[model samples]
Target: MGLIVQKYGGTSVADAQRIQAVAHRIAQRYQQGDQLVVVVSAMGNTTDRLIQLAYQVSPEPEARELDLLLSTGEVVSCTLLAMALRAIGVPAVALTGAQAGIGTDARYGRARILRVDPSRILSHLREGKVAVVAGFQGITEEMDITTLGRGGSDTTAVALAAALKAQRCEIYTDVEGIYTADPRVVPEARKLERISYEEMLELASQGARVMHNRAVELGWVYKVPIYVASSFTEAPGTLICLQEGESMEQRNKVVGIAHDTDVGRITIRGVPDRPGIAAAIFTPLAEAGISVDTIVQNASVERLTDLTFTVAKADLRKAVEMVRHVAQEIGAKEVLWDDVMAKVSIVGSGMQSVPGYAATMFRALYQAGINIELITTSEIRITCLIDASRVEEAVRALHRAFQLEEG
Candidate 1:
């Protein structure tokens, strides 16, 4: 039987009773003759509470000290989970990320998993012990505890799966699985039984939040099978994998629509459309670590062009300042910032060869009474910047237009 690596979110094992429930589920899987490795996040709200505590002590807490502070959250979960499994008569061992040999870069926050040794894990498995690892954390080269950014637990799980060459990596979250669109917005959106990794990457990047985009990219690179399932239900979740040789050729024509509500548009007005002007305007924003999406440039007249792009609302100020600075230096007239934007995207492995997909998307949005502010397209995704208030309605309309849900 193939070994499986499963990662549970904070909500999955939040309290003592919840931990006991997880133990029962794990024990059943253990009885199935499959060796198991479990990764877990901190208990619900624990990390936030820890951060709050740190802030109570100091408003500008040192990063290194903060990492030290936050790492304890997962340690508590791992130890408790191990105890719960043992109480259920299963032999299990809890390990910190360092103990599990999760080696990452020296970055304090948002560090990337560079490698996994897992010798300690293998030893435990050989001794007939299940191994539980703390997720979203790793030890740096300097032996410093570093925290991965948001949804880092998913990356931790996927990284371990790649390391151990496990049969598949299961991400246990609060949601059932990948949907045509977020079910909260599009209630009729169906859970995708199987989704291509590329499509999932687009979905995550567009604010799925169920999984992080970097984790999906790593899975794609490592050819690891990822299963996204709900922790609270028996419903089967979505399996994300590489398409077969031929499936790649036909799968991307039209897939699913993804939408994000946290978008703000920045327009750099009256900028000279000259060499390095666009670069100058965007370079500082890039330096400030903002993810810009849906970039558009209107036709330049004489020498000036209007440039626009979307960045996360959280980073709106930083992005605005950076661009405004560049605009001043370039003698541009003004910088316009619009925070009322949302992104609606359709991603599929099947769109490579499809013609008129753009027209199809436009016609659907038109019928839905949605106005598109900015438009961007790639080989597999067609995205639009629309009014943030209408994001859900636009997503539902697109989901229906693409027939992404079952009848």
Candidate 2:
């Protein structure tokens, strides 16, 4: 058997018992004669607790310092996992991101992986040892520690799989697999047996929590297969792949519903409708490393228009401050923002060729009496920004409208 790369989320190895269980699972693969490389996240809520502690000490902790503090969470988990495996008579060694030769650009909390020099990891595997790695944290050229924002562990696992040419990358989490809708939000939502990289990417971007979009992109680019399953169960899970075959039925079906509540909207009112105006308003935001989503610009009336867009709710304060400066720089009337809105979206690859997908989605929301504040669309995704309070209702309605329940 070839090498296999496996990643366990925080919940899978939340404590000593769970760590021991995961170690046994890895031992099974090793005993079967397969080389294994394992990636582990922090224990449950450890990262959150560290962030809370940082804030308790400082009003605004420095990004570089925060990265240094948060990286310890994964290191602790990795070392403990290695210890667990060794105690059970399996050869194992834990390595930090730097120790594994995972190099990334210097972006602090949301750094991007520039390259992965897997010589150290390969060496460990060649020694017939399970190489345990600390995920989500990497070293930059400046030798500063950086965290890969949210869901970085998943990225690490896939990147290693691609670099090592592993047989497969398995992501073990709390859930069985990706579903049409969040199981908590829609009781009728069904787990998918397989999903395409394109569809998974759309759902991940729109707010599916099972996998991160960045990780999916890495898998797609490397043409690596990813399997998602629950660490505690033996049941077969979903496989995210290039395609499920060329079937017309699969081409035009609504695959999933994704929603995001951690969003904030901003509107720049009374801005001049000029060629460079849009770029001028958004350039500063990009420079500040703020990601903008779902942008809408009203048609000019009397040579003025309003530009509205969305950002992560956590960045609302910083975004507002930056936009306010741009508003004045462009001589706009004023800048207004709202953090009480959430985005709900339905994604399917078949949407591009299928008419009425948008209409059906709109009709479902209309029947539910949910007012849509903003709307955006891609070939396979239709997203509506609605009052945050109505998101659950909207998701339920859409899930029912699409008939996503298992037969």
Candidate 3:
């Protein structure tokens, strides 16, 4: 029998009924003689509730203690799931990330996985027990508990799959599968049957929430096939693999539209343009773990230019604070930021080899009266920053422009 790794999101096992349903699903697979290892997130909004409770106790909790507190949410779900499986006569055991041998660097809130020793999991699997592991967390070198950042559970599952050499990694979530665009935003957006790793990577990075970008990156690096489908449905789902078939190749140049409303733009106005200026402004943010995206520097007029970049809305304040001192040190006029910005992107693998995709995207946005504030491009994707209020309009317009509905 082949070994399989599966991950259930918080929504997939949100409550008692949902947990039981997931147990039954796992039982069916177990009965078929496949070795199963399941990774699960904290149930429903438990993580959020825990964070709220922590803040109530203290305005700013210590990161190590906060991680220790946050890690319990997944443990609670993991134990409950194990109990459910046992009640149903399915052999099962729960393991926390550390107990399961997930080791990480001590980054606290955003720890990175360093290694996974699957001996404990393998021993349990050999005994015909299903290993239900807590996702999104691990132990540091010093044995302190650490939680992976948002969507860290996905990273956990993929890492385990890679380490265990599982046949495939199945990610069961609330949505049916990966779609041409967010179905809620574009009514006619179609679900793709398959997508290449490169394409999916671009889509995930560009803000398609079906899969986390880090998980996709791990899957790509490990060459692990990932299946994304709904936990509540039997409908056909999407397979993320290394390549698409000839039939899929016949589709339009643009395969999907990805949009993120979590965008915040920062503009350091009237900075003296010179060597090392960009580095001076961005280096501190990097060291602070604030990711800067889509940087644009206006052509210098009289050796002065406006430099702009985007960061996650949640990190906007911290990013501004981190850069303000540097901006002044570099002789800048003012540091300005806008949190009401959003990004929309069109992604496909072969778009760079062809012409006219960018023009079509720009024309569609222009026609919809959505002004493009900034632009960026990769080999396979084009992203535009726009007013957050018009993000839906821009997505719909781009989807129709590229005719993704018919994919």
Q: Compared with the true structure, what per-residue lDDT tens digits does model 1 show for residues 1-407?
A: 67899999999989998888888888988999878999999999999999899999998999889988898999999999999999889999999999999998876766778889978898898898889999999998889999887888889889988888899999987899988888888888888888888888988888787788988998999999999999888899999998776555467456678888888888888888789887787778776667787788999998899988888888899888888778889999899997888888888765757677788889999998999888887777888988989888888888888787862
Clash pairs, candidate 3, are none
Q: Candidate 2 on 29-93: residue-level lDDT in tens? A: 89999999999999999999999999999999999999999999999999999999999999999
Ranked by lDDT from best down, the candidates are: 2, 3, 1
lDDT by residue (1-407, candidate 3, tens digit) is 69999999999999999999999999999999999999999999999999999999999999999999999999999999999999999999999999999999998899999999999999999999999999999998899999999989999999999999999999999998999999999989999999988889998888899999999999999999999999999998999988845553553368799999889899999999789998888888988888887888899999999999999988999998988989879999999998998999999877777889999999999999999999999988999999999999999999999888876
TM-score for each of the candidates: 0.94, 0.98, 0.98
Provide the global lDDT of candidate 3 against the true structure: 0.93
Clash pairs of candidate 1? 251-349, 251-350, 252-349, 252-350, 252-351, 253-350, 253-351
In model 3, the Cα lDDT at residue 215 comes to 94
Give the candidate number with the greatest lDDT.
Answer: 2
lDDT of all predictions: 0.87, 0.94, 0.93
Per-residue lDDT value at 303 in model 1? 89
TM-score of 2: 0.98
- lDDT (C-alpha) at residue 77 in model 3: 91
